[model samples]
Target: MDDIVRQALAKWPDVPSCTGWLLLDRRGNWRMRDEAAQAGGAAGTPIRHTALLAFINRNYEADESGQWFFQNGPQRVYVELAYTPWVVRLSADAGGALSLTDQAGGVFEPSAVYVDDEGGVLFVDRSAPPRVAVLHDHDLEVFSDHAQLADDGVSGAFFWRDGVALPLQAVRRADVAGRFGFVVSPATRA
Candidate 1:
């Protein structure tokens, strides 16, 4: 959390949280939803401001109930997630070593890899509460290159650069939020 935001919270501790106003899309874009957009169930306009994006990323956090939000100074701006709480991009070093980086620019080392029925890849880090990050769609090809399917076809293994093959488990799209302990839409919860 930012020091300025902490000061703001101390100064005004009773600020009501805002929901249905901000969204984090599947592709890792921060969106600002207006009244019309919220009413119509639209994705809203993408926020392209670099500084604002950085600020939001820096202060992003999750509540005990698994609701993700951006601590905007005093008020908490709840985030509506299109998929998982985090979106990760896959990259390879010069020696063909794979690394994962989240939308917030934080480097993630996944403890497990999962593949949904729809073929979407997800990575889970070994945090206390655990964080599930879906691989960005654009990097699917790169991910496929490092994966090997088992004889059953449903299971597989992901070969990391260090020669460690992480077992790929199967998951259902509908069970993602519940299994990972995150809320997809905070507006509905609110």
Candidate 2:
């Protein structure tokens, strides 16, 4: 178990309601396999909290290649790599103007942000030129909702080839930091 994961588990013991958690190892393959273990009250059946905590304390081992796991219950999520700025920070001024900042130092004053039902952040830039975006890894980016506003609006649905942006009509549904969200760019791309 990583120090952050440990701290999260300790802080939020309720478990089910927690949305996000991270595990990092020297190796790239980190997986969390959550199984039912058993159904109903068996002879030594442990509840969700007890079983999860036990697994975290004991089975939280990393291999020589730096692979780690964070099994919750029935969700086996795998993380192949790691990066900084795992969480994004958004601030709004008294006038309702918003500014976004991530760990990568991306500061974007986007026109608006649409938070989807799945709890993802979609920043729409209608004022900026479509030819350039500040996000580094556009391929793994996702959109909060699939609603199309106008041609001038730039959706977070572009992929990268050789560090260049390629627009994709499909909306993204995963969390990819290096590319999608705003970070400080040395200069404007457009």
Top candidate, metric lDDT: 1
Q: How does candidate 1 score on lDDT?
A: 0.91
Give the per-residue lDDT of model 1 (tens digit) for 29-77.
9999999999999999999999999999999999989999999999999
Candidate 2 TM-score versus the reference: 0.23
User: Number of clashes in every candidate structure?
Assistant: 0, 8
- lDDT measured at residue 155 in model 2 versus the true structure, 0 to 100: 43
- TM-score, per-candidate, Cα-based: 0.95, 0.23
Residue pairs with colliding backbones in model 1 are none
Q: What is the C-alpha lDDT of each candidate?
A: 0.91, 0.33
